[model samples]
Target: MFRHTKATDLLNSGVPIHVGMRYMGHKSANMFMHYAQTLSKTHEAEFLRYRKITTDGREYQQDPHEMYEAIALSKRTDRVLPHGYCTLPPRQTCDKGNACLTCTKFVTDESFEPVLRQQMEATDGLIAERQEAHEARFGEPMSQENIWLKGRFQEKNALSKILHTISAVRTSDGTFTPLRGAGSPQGRQEEN
Candidate 1:
């Protein structure tokens, strides 16, 4: 247990895997990887340390306790979704990858709007470049790759629209307040 914890801690602390393996006297990467696996709770704690949230036009590290409370509340209220938390059972599988923008299980709050918009812009740029290349290669009709890009762009556009519509209410004193109630559909038009 000590060795495993030490290995995981070292890796999580940004130590190179090869260095860790050397320190641990491991002969192969397989054994080193086994020791490097972090417990879920430990991983969550590490993730929270680096999590940043923008509030009141300033960025701040999220309070882990508050984040835990929010997650717990969201779970109890069935507000957890794919991108965030969702009502899905723990054992259920939703085979989505990092394509959260196209997942029907995705949920986003006002805090995530800026990131969503950024993603939309990036996707649009990629689609434009890919479309240009496709047109040069196959002039008359859209190629399969171009068609796929259009579909993904549409999905991202829809998500961006939904995020644009959900703004956090601001008080007279300039404090941002989250919307009341559990998570809303925000955007869930596609599945993984």
Candidate 2:
């Protein structure tokens, strides 16, 4: 039940940086440190409880995939593969490599699957554009100003498209989730 915000709050209140890094799956302390300033001092007491759990190195806090696997295991059905992690059905004849588009299996359980497909299409295009831009600008070390300009344009474009995606996927249940965090589908499929 721990929300991402709660995990972040726990990380900034004097919790060992390494433990926070572990919890967040951040490859480096620097990644976690960037968000450290966002933590609230008022939540120190809550963080103390987190510290107590990690005081002994005996227990391993499960990784994100492990948590997903545990949930999947509990929900397994006769049709579901072992661990309830079903493989994608064969891709449609479309060359976009969209396994989800042709996959009937995913439609049964995941309500957000369509949102994921749409977002992936958007992201794949964006990534190709970035690669082209980078290649066009190659052979010269990008000046900070040039880099910032490109990054700013890309960021604004991504944010606008993501907002559109959220609007498209806001269901009758009023639950809308983004496909991935701040990156393209190729980089973030593991998060699902």
Candidate 1 to truth, TM: 0.44
Q: Give a tens-digit lDDT track for model 2, residues 95-171.
A: 32333222222211123336444555666677667666776889554454666446544544533443443456455
Per residue, candidate 1 scores C-alpha lDDT tens digits across 1-192 of 999899988877656568989999998888898889765555454434322322112223344455555556424544443334332344566575555545554444454555666766777787778778877887854565556866776666666555444432434774344222112122232221
| Off by more than 4 A, model 1 | 1-87, 141-146, 168-175, 180-192
Q: Compute each candidate's TM-score over C-alphas.
A: 0.44, 0.19
Best by TM-score: 1
Alpha carbon lDDT at 124, candidate 2: 61
Candidate 2's TM-score reads 0.19
Top-lDDT candidate index: 1
- Prediction 1 global C-alpha lDDT: 0.55
